[model samples]
Target: MKKIYLWFTENYLSIIVPLILLLIWESCSRFNLIETKFLPSPSWIIREFFILLSNGELVRNLLISIIRVAEGFFIGVSLGIIVGIQVALNKNLQKSVRFIFGILRPIPVIAWIPVLILWLGIDESSKIAAISIGSFWSVLVSVVQAIRNVDKKYLEVAKVLRKDYKTTMLDVILPSTLPEIFTGIRIGIDVAWRSVIAAELIAASAGIGYMIMYARELFQIDIVLVGVFSIGLTGIVIEELVKVAERHLLRWNTNIYQEEVTRKI
Candidate 1:
């Protein structure tokens, strides 16, 4: 009883709200208070999830979306980092890159779908292009700004030392800007992953987004909810993975700061 009370105290709000909502939802479904077509019960969605999983349909579609995200994210973030580095290192190229990408920045990932389809056709290439654009812009903007906002004192000292742009970028800017670059990567990957669903939903014949859209057309609310839940859970997992990578890779930064503090003390 004591353990139970402690557990409840620790997990109450998080567990209770969703439990109550599910209970209410289930009751509504059982009593016909809500149309099954519009809002299927929690149990129905869960059962459908298991059914889809057993048949491999859910896994297959999810894999397709994940693959698309991987390919596009690699292309986009790689380009973003490369271009950002060049832009920071060269004034002439910086102006050209900034102007070109800036004009294209406001256009959204979903918005690019139609243009991509028309240019590349309604195929995997277009879908990947849409996802890539989403990632590229996010990382590009973050990387450029991260460099621009690098601790001014370092830049000032570098300038006084007559450091060239390349030297300053390599010695002073790169180290300081890594954290922000990681942040950009996290955001860019999330954006690209999200774009996969929309790209597939809008045009493709396969993928998680297509599954949801297809289920909606068939009036299978449970399946639609299952797909949505899959996306949400996958997103949470992706975010946590990025955070773990960031902490691991930047662990040295933490040690350096601690050493500096200890010296001052």
Candidate 2:
């Protein structure tokens, strides 16, 4: 009990702030301080969330969305890192792709939905493509900028040691850039989420975005809010997962660097 109490004391603020806000929101809704149409009572949304969950609609749609995000994020981030490194290091490579990427990158990924629908059709392919494209830019730009921003001093150290291209990149450039690259990856996640939703809203017959849009059409605002909350909550979960992975990987990186320095000395 004491341990639980201590844990609560440490973590209470995080819980309490949202709880307080929910109370205020519930009061407003109950008192009609805010219309139930625009801002449904917390209780109503919770009730709807459970109803959807019990009926398996929410789980099915959420699972579908999760799979789509996983596949698209993997493909997009893999390509982004591979291309970003080459473009950053190889002027010739940059020259080849720069013109087209420059033209295409300026356009928002959401704007490509109509064209994607036309080319790929309103199926999983089109939606996944939308997510991949949306996830690409943030990571690509992050990697490219990270390489450019690598401390010249590190390069000077590599030169002094006469490190080969592959060795230098593996040991120096990558470690130097991982943090920034991860930052971009974090941004790409949000983009990926938004892209999936937009694609679903526009063309999908299923998924969370479709659920929200369908609810809107029927003027089921409580259901709409439930979908909105589901998306937000799930997005938070995904980001937290990434952050946990980042912390572990970064800690490992630090250990590797220390071992290398110690060995050299």
Candidate 3:
């Protein structure tokens, strides 16, 4: 009970502040203290939300957005991990690829929208491409850094045991670098989600982004707000899932790290 109380206390501000702001907004709108044109009341938004929910439009659009994000994120993370590992293992490869990545990494994902549309015809392919490009660099950089930062002592011990490169990498390097790789994957998913939404806003016929864009076009502020809130909520849920996955996969490392911290203390 005490632990539960402490947890609630720690998280009270995060929960209370949002609730307070929402209540204030709803109150102001209900009392006509604020113009409904620009700021729709929570009740009005809730009604519209129910309407969209009943009609299944919201779910449909949400599913489409989720599908695009999943497709793009998986592809980007896979390629990024492979490339990152390769570069980290080979000094020559790292040097050769550095110039290209340096130039491409700084370009905003939205900047590719026009070119992708032209090349891929404003279809799912273009949107996926945009998301992939947006997420790849961040994941690649994170994985590379994680691999590079792996403790050299592990490699030395593996070598002393006559472990081959593949064995060493599988047992030592991959495990040691997993936490960093997972962090990168978390960030990559965020970038992919944002990039996919932007792409969908520009060209998609069915997606949360499309719904938001359509709402904006029809001057339905409530629908727009619903879409915004939906995005934020979805992002938070996905991030939590990633954290759960990280915990499961890195359980061993977590114990080791905790023990080391205990020793230090």
Best by TM-score: 3
**Candidate with the larger TM-score of 2 and 3:** 3
All candidates in order of TM-score, best leading: 3, 2, 1
TM match of model 3 to true structure: 0.92
Candidate 1, residues 1-265, lDDT tens digits: the string is 9999999999999988999999999999999999987888889999999999999999999999989999999999999998887787578998776777777889888988988999999889999999889999888878888888876876777787787877766667776787999999999988998899999888889999999999889988889999999998888888899899988877766468445333322
**Counted clashes in each candidate structure:** 0, 0, 0
* RMSD of candidate 1 to true structure, Å: 4.0
Q: After superposition, how far is residue 223 of candidate 1 from its true place, in Å?
A: 1.1
Better of 1 and 2 by TM-score: 2
TM-score winner between 1 and 3, please give it. Answer: 3
TM-score of each: 0.85, 0.89, 0.92
Deviation in Å, model 3, residue 6 alpha carbon = 5.4
**Deviation in Å, model 1, residue 38 alpha carbon:** 1.2
Worst 10 contiguous positions by lDDT, candidate 2: 256-265
